[model samples]
Target: MTLPFFVYGTLRPGETNHDRFLRGRTSSEEPGRLTGSVLYDGPGYPYAVDEPGGVVHGELVTARPGDYRELLAVLDRLEEYAPGDARNLYERVERGVVRARDGLVMQAWVYVAAPPAAARLRAGGRRIEGGDWRIRS
Candidate 1:
């Protein structure tokens, strides 16, 4: 699916990977939130873990038409993701991300913590309260 992506960590604006990866590849970036998940701090990034009654703030990024496939491949590589891979740290899933502007729920690609990481984070990872990685303190 060539849906837009919901990014909450390093891939978000002003973050290190944003410019390196999405700067010119995107058509737009707008505030959004993924429900039923919480943000957890990773080594240098952040992971969104599935959880009840949770929401993670982020941006919904639409890729430029021509860069879709290339951007998708690059992001898969960057996220260390491979479809059906058992060792993946993150699993890209299609989820409803509510746009902050109009409260519109749009289906977008969300990279959530894979099984191993999700279990660990759910058990006792450092949660980013309020779900906004940008203002985490």
Candidate 2:
């Protein structure tokens, strides 16, 4: 079965690497929100972390089953993120969403920076609301 991915970083469409990775590969894209997290701008890219009252904005992308591996590789490269590094650059986490007003349960893949990494990133970063990347722009 194809996996549903919740992308809050570079993999997000309209961002820098969108055309190179997700342009035509996305079967479906929808506004999705991930709770218990916040966005922090780092030296090179943004990072998310577990924080109460914070929300990470992203798109829910449903990709082809056959494209899973390529998708992972793309994310790994784009985020400069890994699943289980000690630095905790990015770790895949369970994401919960209520699809479009239907309130149906939606679960997908989300990545959060390690708690320590998030700490060193400094504070006062804004939380992304409504799953819109343009909110920061």
TM-score of 1: 0.98
Tell me which residue pairs clash in candidate 2: none
* Per-model TM-score on C-alpha atoms: 0.98, 0.78
Instruction: Give the candidate number with the greatest lDDT.
Output: 1
Determine which window of 10 residues in candidate 1 has minimal summed lDDT.
Answer: 117-126
The count of residue-pair clashes in candidate 1 stands at: 0
| Sequence-dependent TM-score of model 2 | 0.78
* Candidate 2 local lDDT, 1-137, one digit each (tens): 24588876667777776678887777788877777777776554567777787776677888765777888778766665675667556776667854555656588877777667776754655444443455654
Ten contiguous residues minimizing lDDT sum, candidate 2: 125-134
